[model samples]
Target: MSQPAAATNAFLVATQRALDYAGFAPPSPGATCVLVFDSTLWNTHIASVHGLLNAVEQARAMRFRFERDREPYAVGHAVWRIVLAACLNVPISAVPLVSTASGQPHLPGTRWVTSLSHSGSWVAIAVGEADCIGVDIERSPSQMNLSALMPRFCTPAECVQLSGLPTPLRETRLLALWTRKEALLKAFGTGLNEDPASMAAAENTIVAAPASCGRTAVCHVRDLDLPASLVGALAVPAGAMSHRLYWLDRCSNDVYGCNSAETSIRSN
Candidate 1:
């Protein structure tokens, strides 16, 4: 495994320790859990990685009451294993794996959801059995072509609004809007091919409807107050969503969970 990012290594170690202390080993009698992780950080050792995969497969096999080869599902399953191993107290190898029709990862038979995104050197994921959830991370590079993509991915109004801003602010706003729409699409279970510009973020929610899995969907946008280095957005069900934003500087074991009361937004 590549060394975890300087900002996240310590947090991963502490999380590992907590799981170990909780007796969260693989092969629980029978239970289901959500696993989340940054795909870029996991190191895959054949023996160790497989061990965690086995644990999750065993759990899934038990859930389905069958015996079959779960190994095929374990090969590209690194991130799934790490998150399950930590959050669910199981061996990373033991997390069950499933995918949506559009190829988005998911935990089957329940509302438990997980999504992944990678930007530059960083990766992020979110796992929960919430009503709906999506998380995305992007590397803020100095040379992103805002003008070139604005027309393609942004609405006419948004493009005009973005163009009106000072160069520096316009660049930041373009990226923020892009990430928000992308997160909304991921949550809606549709990738970029879904034409995200149809959706617009207004007053903390996305207003345009995007097509996903052959159905049109909308999302509530909640801007997360992370460090200036990071611009994060979350999408969940409108009106009833509970958005808990956090800045997890893992290398320092510092997780800043936002405590502000839940805010409501309407996408319609």
Candidate 2:
């Protein structure tokens, strides 16, 4: 298995190839793809800024992309812009991504559903035909204290179940559960602002939130086998069974490189 950095690179290459296979090309294959990293920059905020910028630059359209001219609220926005461009053929600077009153993002004049997530240095985004979808990626072997975070994030039963597992196993289990819930919350547009302790994941299923939250959206969870270093989950309102996966790579020459797809979306 590839280490985290290598695996992420592989995914980038894979995504770019998938886009090519899908018949979209913003630039030549041999050109460099841009992936900017600032050693002095903090990971938390810069992730979103770079993610959005990269997505726009890759698509060669910035109309819908977030304004890189200002500070970013979350790296997820950057990923969202790129995913939108790749899937919808729109520009990152496009004004369609205006937020709803509830903070849900919407594309103007369209019903496309979009979601974004970032873990460590990598981010993933998913877009679908008007179906509520949430995507999340978490860097595993997390530096956080599982014991303390588990109680705060896990359900009581989950805590009990985790306690019975070996330390290594327990950590993986806990992270998976956490990623699932985080995905759900992102779908809700609440993210970590919601109390994780109130959320629960059992049997790879997220228990429906209380009726007070308005309507219950259909939820589906899948473990994306990207790398052991990262845990990714997808939450979509129960909908269709088709999705295509792609890998993307950025070179320094203001051009993006595409790697052919190694996996295709299958019926769930």
Candidate 1: what lDDT? 0.52
Model 1 ranges off by over 4 Å: 1-14, 18-80, 85-91, 206-208, 250-268
- The lDDT values for all models are 0.52, 0.54
- lDDT per residue as tens, model 1, 1-268: 4443432344345445433433333322221222222222233222233444455454653363321223323322443456544555454434555666686777665445666655543455555555455666565643578767888788878987888888778888887887788777777777776776766764375543554446544557666555566666666655433433322222323222112222333444
In Å, residue 180's CA in model 1 sits off its true spot by: 0.4
Q: Report the Cα lDDT for residue 239, model 2.
A: 44
N/CA/C clash count, model 1: 14
Q: Residue 132 lDDT in model 2? A: 62
State the lDDT of candidate 2 residue by residue for 231-267, as single tens digits. 7766655444434344444443333444432222232
CA shift of 204, model 2, Å: 4.5
Question: What TM-score fits each model?
Answer: 0.64, 0.65
Candidate 2 stretches with Cα past 4 Å from truth are: 1-18, 21-79, 89-91, 100-103, 203-207, 250-268
